[model samples]
Target: MSRTAPAPAGEAAPPRPRRRIPGLGALRESGRLFALAGTTVREAFRRPFQTRELIEQFWFVAAVTILPAALVSIPFGAVIALQVGSLAQQLGAQSFTGGASVLAVIQQASPLIVALLIAGAGGSAICADLGSRTIREELEAMEVMGVSPVQRLVVPRVLACMLVAVLLNGLVSVVGTLGGYFFNVMLQHGTPGAYLSSFSALAQLPDLYISEIKAVVFGFIAGVVAAYRGLNPRGGPKGVGDVVNQSVVITFLLLFVVNVVLTAIYLQLVPQKGA
Candidate 1:
């Protein structure tokens, strides 16, 4: 026994060197995201409206983001209107901006902005809350208590995030449309209501479908990226801060990539320009 003890030594295996592959990492991330999305849907249905957490989450995103996004978006619309307006008139196609601008803005920009807003509020929230729990070992305690943190803590928030995303997208579109409407009134001497009616008319069923679908995908990416960063953060407040930055940056980048692909898909799937 003493000889056996002398012959045995145990040490923690060296940490595997971290490796990252761009496309592979994204594909793996996509798989993880898909699982998280399933969990999110399950938790959302399980709790139903018991917690009011979903409502609170929606309010947090919409309220916190409304002002700045409002400020940014109206002008974005006006700018689009102004530029596109001139081009449309020059090309004798001034009546067509509704479909073009509304489709582009709602399907494309709205999702991106919503992702950024959630990244600032909900994404930061997921990181800070989870990171603090991690630092204090609350998550560990849950583990000891036989609760899987992912199931207990993450699933609900992930579901709430997707719900919040829907609301956020709606908020941005409304605010942006309104702002753009006002811009047309002020800049081009067009009535806001009339301009908006034009926009509404052009915002066809397919456009709404595209916009909503984009939101779901973008929201999923934002949720998973934020969750991954929060779950894998380095120790301490400094580390949490680092993770926050990483979460936002990665989510934004992924959101953009997704937006591009979704745009391409939309073009292929939606009715052609002339049709």
Candidate 2:
């Protein structure tokens, strides 16, 4: 047997070598989120799917986000019309105003607006629902019963967000284009025939395809972030509130970054053609 000498009475043991790594905590959290996303994806493809839950979530998300999408899109269209029409008149290209407005809305505004609404409205709802379940020990109960909350709850919500986001993008595009048409022709005295005629002149099929893709990606990110925060909430009701706020902020930040990257790539791959 070996005898070891104890430390001096007043001396403290040397602090265990502090393991310091820049952004270690953030990296850990990010890894955990990615793992959670993987689990959700895996669950999504498994058998005995949650059809009713998916439908319910789809309806819920659509109901919560549709009105806001419409309201924002109409004004977005009007603003584009106002600005584009003013500039086009100066350049003697006023007939291009409708095309420009439609292109702008479909290419950029609708996807971003739909994403924001989903993050603010549907994402928050998911956080609240999951947080409530967490606080009530429902998640633990499911685990005890060998049931996965991820499969039951997260997958449905995520799929619903993605589906509704694409639908909402289409809705926003139509509403925004119509709003721009009304403002340009009625208010700005733009020729109706020119507005209608030039609408498809500058717009391309790729723009619509890319916009829908962006919507799907944004919705998936928002849903995942919301689910992760909600599932891992700490403290109590206040924690749930904090999680909701954080989810929205993170979703917004990620959406903007993704938008920039995707836009850059799209512009590189498919250079815009002149009308």
For each candidate, give its TM-score against the true structure: 0.77, 0.92
Off by over 4 Å in 1: 1-56, 189-202
**Weakest lDDT window of 10 consecutive positions for candidate 2:** 11-20
Candidate 1 lDDT score relative to the true structure: 0.70
lDDT of 2 by residue, 43-63 (tens): 999878999999999999999
Q: Model 1 over residues 214-252: C-alpha lDDT tens digits?
A: 877777777777777777668688899898988888888
**For residue 39, what is the lDDT in candidate 2?**
97
Candidate 1, position 97, lDDT: 54
**lDDT score, candidate 2, position 238:** 93
Q: What is the lDDT of residue 246 in candidate 2?
A: 93
lDDT of 1 at 179: 61
lDDT of each: 0.70, 0.93
- Segments in model 2 whose C-alpha atoms lie over 4 Å from true places: 1-6, 9-14, 17-22
Among the numbered candidates, top lDDT falls to: 2
